[model samples]
Target: MKRTLTILSLTTSFALALGACNQESPKQQQEVSAPAQTVEKPESAEVVQDTIKKSIPSEATGRIGDASIKITYHSPGVRERVVWGGLVPYDQVWVTGAHKATTVEFDRDLIIAGKSVGPGKYALFTIPGRDEWTVILNKNWDQHLADEYDQKEDILRTKVKPYSLEHPQERLKYRVEDGGEAEAGIRISWEKIGIRLPVAGK
Candidate 1:
């Protein structure tokens, strides 16, 4: 009777140990199958262009007697490109700048190329030619390029002769020079040519 009881106890313990191992086997398999989550990294941004546009802002200011005169424009570089008949076409209205219309302001009434102009701001435009260029002053000072330019809005139109520059100018430039008393000269230079327009108080 004692030997049989010991055998029964040993059999029960072995069965319980086997059952515990079987129950733990599934949890171990689940831990091994599922890996830890990881975060994904984003890609680096790229640069689109290597260089910026060439057009830049320019301003010229001077006094004609007691009247203040100012000109604001965009200066474009020659960059080995033909400017006269190629980039800036002839016989057409040009903005005289790159993105916006060129502006001319006067503190008092002034005479430009024999035409009377405003005491306020005005848009400056030009029609370029090989020998002579026509300069126009419009009442509409705020505009984009020459696309919105209208001939009916012109307040003053005058013709000026273009001269060849012995030294080449790489960029477009506008200058107002004080010529003695009430007289002032507006000079526009670009590429290999230049033009001068006389201005005086009316």
Candidate 2:
């Protein structure tokens, strides 16, 4: 009788332990499966290519003297288009960017062409020519393209010589060359052409 009682107690304990293990096994399996479901899918190649084909909203900035010079615009690519004389005409006012007029902002007063320009945002317009390009800073920085361009609203205009690039630039880019604390340059480059606008911080 004693031996039977002991055997029955051992059997009961073994069954309870087995039940507890079974319950915990399913929970462990669920935890393992959850991570698989949460695995993220990689972006498709077509989606990546689409983004590259579109015009990129771009910005470039620099520090000269006490101000932060900022350039904001959409960068368009040169997909084998004749940029200088075809897509972008020669001698007409261009927005200097694809969608909207490019904006140039100086957080502090700066001098361009020996004239003091108050610290503010201005629409950057350009007249592209074979030999010379006219760079204009207009008061209205809110217009699209050159549609609402009023030369009467121009704050500053300067003619700069255009030079040929040894290597073609695939995308339109603006660069602020930091000459020093007193003098600097703003350079525009696209489709094998380059223009430099001299600026002074003194």
Candidate 3:
């Protein structure tokens, strides 16, 4: 009877030890699983956001003389509120386009309606007006700034009369048109504003 009791006691001790080991394995699994949950959530959100910005295609083109001027305006619509709402704000220099400074080139120095312009690329900028507008020619052709534009680099500043468009423009556009007798009009228009700069050959 003692021998049988001893065997029963040994079996009971082994079963208790097995039960304790099974309980500890689940506790170890919970500790390992908790750390994995913390790391994955924010990383997944960032990847989704970056995908959205890449989907927008922002580019446009036009010509400004014998010279072909490529214009890349803002992809998003240019509104008076966005352009005037302290972003492009009023009575200040605007680069006139989105990416690089808006570029205008002349094939050679020609008397643009008696005004002399040398052959080269110039940065085109503008100052909006309620009654009239100003088209500016600046020597510096690269770099972008809302506040960093220097008027000293400006080669010329000319007044233009802004006209109301019959139809709303979806994107800003520039083109050179035959102005008769070796002259052309460098027309810039968008939204409600349409202005032309007349250029003539020397």
Candidate 4:
């Protein structure tokens, strides 16, 4: 009778241990399977291209004397259409940016061609001519709508030298360089047009 009771107890303990192991096995399997299902997909090449396409026009800054000027231009696309008397006509105003109007700023009042121009933000425009071109600075700030341009609103107008280009400019660009005293020239160039606006810092 004693032997039979011991054998029965051992059998019950083994069955309970087996049941516990079976219950824990399912939880272990669930933990291992979850990471496989939650794996992330890699980004496609098309998605990366779209991100670059949306960010076209970019900006760069330059310092000339006490003045800090921001140069903004259009990044590639449809820029080849920029031509004199076709897209940008002779003796007409053009916003120096492709999408929005480009701007130049001065910390204090500056002079251009012996004309007193106040310190503030201005929209840069140019009137292309054969020998000389006119650089215009308007008090307007915003650019994309194209309606802010007003001829009578011009703050300063000055004649700049126009030079013939040896090679075609693929994109329009502008830069501010250091000039002696408080002065600098704002250069505008694209394909055939090269003009400069001399700003006296002193």
* Candidate number of the best TM-score: 2
Which of the predicted structures, 1 or 3, would earn the higher lDDT when compared with the native?
A: 1
lDDT of 2 by residue, 78-142 (tens): 88778888989998999988888899999888888678999999999999988888999999999
- Give the alpha carbon lDDT tens digit for every residue of 32-151 in model 3: 998788777786454322223221234334343454444434433454334433544567777776656777766656555357888887788888777777788888877673455788
- lDDT of each residue in 1-202, candidate 4, tens digit only: 9999999999999999999999999999999997766664353223422223332675657666566667665644224465777766677666655667777666666666678877777777767776778778777766762467887888888787788767666566676767766556777667766677776654
Expressed as tens digits, the lDDT of each residue in 1-202 for candidate 1 is 9999999999999999999999999999888765532122233345454133578898999988678988999998887788999999999999987889999998988778887666999999999998899998998889998888999999888899999988988778999988877557799999899998898766
The lDDT, on a scale of 0 to 1, for candidate 1 is 0.86
Lowest lDDT block of 10, candidate 1:
36-45
Model 2 gets an lDDT of: 0.88
Structural similarity to truth (TM-score) of each candidate? 0.72, 0.73, 0.60, 0.62
- Candidate lDDT scores, in order, read 0.86, 0.88, 0.67, 0.69
Among all candidates shown, the one with the greatest lDDT: 2
Off by over 4 Å in 4: 1-55, 75-82, 181-183
Sort the candidates on TM-score, descending order.
2, 1, 4, 3
Better of 3 and 4 by lDDT: 4
Cα error of candidate 3 at position 47, Å: 33
**In model 2, what lDDT does residue 101 have?**
87
